[model samples]
Target: MDHSIRLQIEEREAASLAPYATLSRETKGRFRPEEECPIRGAFQRDRDRIIHCKSFRRLKHKTQVFLAPTGDHYRTRLTHVLEVSQIARTISVALRLNGHLTEAIALGHDLGHTPFGHAGEAVLDELYPQGFRHYDQSLRVVNILEKKGEGLNLTVEVLDGIAKHSKGRREILPEDLSELPATMEGRVVRIADIIAYVNHDLDDAVRAGILSESQIPSHLQKLFGPTHSGRIGAMVHDLVVQTLKNGGEILAMTPNLLEGIAELRSFLYENVYETNRVHDDFIKAKKVLRELYEYFINKDDHWEKVIDYDETTPREQMVCDFIAGMTDRYALDLYTNIFLPKPWSVM
Candidate 1:
């Protein structure tokens, strides 16, 4: 059934696209298929592929704010991906965009992230002179990491958005604002990540008793609003409103909103991320990750077991895939068993 021609396909049509978990539109080029494009639903299949991949499963044990196993309430990468999906879909629906495609982009955005948060990413970047980035890793994850050694073969637009979603990259937008569904649907989710983390991390910080709402800088506190949900709503609403107001295109955040977000982020950095407990764990993760990288990179035999590619393949990517696939506990155990001195037994 062709989905492009329906005059606002009902909820059932959207739901029907769910079963074929790894198919894509036959559309050519890297462009997102318009409502008039050829072929069937591609976005839904991409979403399903990501949902079933090993990397997606590993997200459950990766950190969003706090370390894994700290407590149930703290957000893991899986939960974070779900939240971003929800938020992106909501915005997509309100604007009559391709919600499923937006959702696929959001769901797979974090697949390449390290076991710890930015700390782990920083360690890897330092270890590899050529550098490592989760965004590129995400593309590699979906396109080459899964599927019995084959990638999901997702749509080009989806891949482009995933690769360039980082703040430092160029913005996504249509050549003319007249186009519907817009080009930056992926970009929307990029900013949405910061929004999700800023508000949720604050909520977690308050819950963990590290900081209070009253302690938030007054200039930004009013924007923080009376409740966590309220603050997040305001942020999301502001972003959508701003983007739409710019003729349905995403714009760089205003200095004020950017500053406010930075302040809130700074608060999290000082009170939550930089605390001795969290930093200690992050350091341990770095040590483990570095050792694991070196071990696998140096020992061709071990690398062969975990990584299928040849030595001709880039060493950095081999190490990345090995580390990116690790569960938090698995990483820790590997590090302890390999690097730490073990007590002698009488056996």
Candidate 2:
């Protein structure tokens, strides 16, 4: 391949042309041939903006499985996003797709996840009678939360993919998927999300002593192969080969592959999520969150600093949002102080 084209293979085509892509499609401008390419430099800037955002940084303190402040090996949401980005970029490169776009989508995919993984999400969802979802919250983060007024103003493609990345099937419309700028790249990220979580969640479960390698059923082991690492390697390899062969179409894991992953998920749910080990912590989290919610709702002065909204906004949401944005240890400390009334003497 010529150096220009080889570089294209190495870097995402979109990154170079992101700035042009940001221009309205109807807008007219004269530029060099390369400037008018499908991918634009603005997309790269947008991805970079997301990476540097405070919310993105806070992902390091958020949970993937266990609550924050646990052991170091436990997967934080930030690490999980990086893993997904690695997997998606590998797939993108193997298939001669835009690695930058895929990686950008992967990194931004989980920006809306709550502080405590699914547990904190569940609490927020329950608190919202109208229903709350991380995907929407993620969009909110990029569109509103990043700055005081306008957001990073990312390209439509990145924004749209982040908004509908979750395959809820019901939440996304066909038009939404059709209108995406880099459909194949988005699909790579979508599948990568599942791939990263399933494999790593199992790894975390095993390390926490909630599951054993032998606990993986015999039938599953034979079909999907042994151990979490082995399964992840096989799955990623299989997907890469199949995607390259099939022109970048996402290759859904076979029934056996699906079953194996499900078994692992089920084991974690039963052994880790449902057990008293988790519930004990959850009970405390619930109490602390509720108390903090009540505290912030009643106090207008403190709410002003944490939120952009006026005092008229409901306290429950403000408190939840503030708590949701906190790093793991910060939330825990806040909870302890408010509900347990811990005294902190200021120097």
Candidate 3:
């Protein structure tokens, strides 16, 4: 009811959080400074902003692993972000870190991902001059694309976490911490991203009949767990226990646990992602995005109609933004509308 609730929350955080936890009150602040909210702390405000933004909403139709999966239970990008948020918050709460910041970062981390998952991403990278990384596009979304070029103006901490969240094929906890987010809460989200995807993607793969439970190496099954829930629980528990044991100095996984996850990831790549079962869809998705990219880039009138802001932005960058913002259905529809022949109608 009171406007000063933010201060009360800040006080509670200062008293309860670990020394390493990022304090919302002391955020590096937004790119464009403004008056503090009456009731919301900075990170809380950021979380709310991301939840309400357009890009966040578009995540529902974006691909996590499968392209246009007919199965209702498959994990879409939105579900993936929610799961990442849930897992990251759990770890943050367990470690006495900043949960709100972690959630904000987790939710916003994939806002820039292209439709049709990494296949669309690969096509964009190949076509664009400077190349496209969804992490950077996500930062661009929050900083320049959302709010019609006004941007989200989120705090530097949120921006940093979103920017650095991608681990690609790299190790979960690299020796080089410099490239990781500066805050421990941010780092928590980074590791949580990996945990969420590896487990869930495998689950989706199994559900799609792409892989069977027995196909997962027995050693890995033993190391992580026999079930999806069991593996996630094991990974989350290990991360929280390790971080707390180290006094929140570093967000970590036991070397054995890390190796188990890494091995599982390799298995997914070799068996599911690279196999023709997935690649057929991936190849089609790539062609769809590639054709769309070329059409928008070469057709000036169509490009002008699609992009409505800032004439000075590079054509390639604008094309990337347009494509990256599209959902799986939207991309398919646009491609069909532009390329497919419609039935003739008599007046």
Q: What would the TM-scores of all predictions be?
A: 0.81, 0.79, 0.97
Candidate structures ordered by lDDT, highest first: 3, 1, 2
Q: Which segments of candidate 2 are over 4 A away from where they belong?
A: 1-40, 167-182, 304-307, 310-317, 342-347
Quote model 1's TM-score: 0.81
Clashes of each: 0, 8, 0
Q: Which candidate is the best by TM-score?
A: 3
Question: Per-residue CA lDDT of candidate 3, range 19-132, in tens?
Answer: 888998889898788989988899998999999999999999999989987789999999999999999999999988899999999999999999999999999999999989
Candidate 2 per-residue lDDT over residues 60-141, each given as its tens digit: 9887877764687988999999998988887667665655567667788778777777677777777755556887778767
Screening candidate 3 with a backbone cut-off below 3 angstroms (N, C-alpha, C), the clashing residue pairs are none
- Comparison by lDDT, 1 against 2, better one: 1
RMSD, candidate 1, Å: 5.9
**Candidate 2 TM-score versus the reference:** 0.79
| Model 3, global lDDT | 0.91
Q: After superposition, how far is residue 116 of candidate 2 from its true place, in Å?
A: 1.4
Question: In candidate 2, what residue range of length 10 has the lowest lDDT sum?
Answer: 25-34
> Tens-digit lDDT track for model 1 on 169-280?
2222223334322255665676677777778788887877778878877777676577877777777676667756666534444557766777777778888888987788
Q: After superposition on all CA atoms, what RMSD does each candidate show versus the true structure?
A: 5.9, 6.2, 1.5
Which residue runs of candidate 3 sit more than 4 Å off their true CA positions?
Answer: 302-307
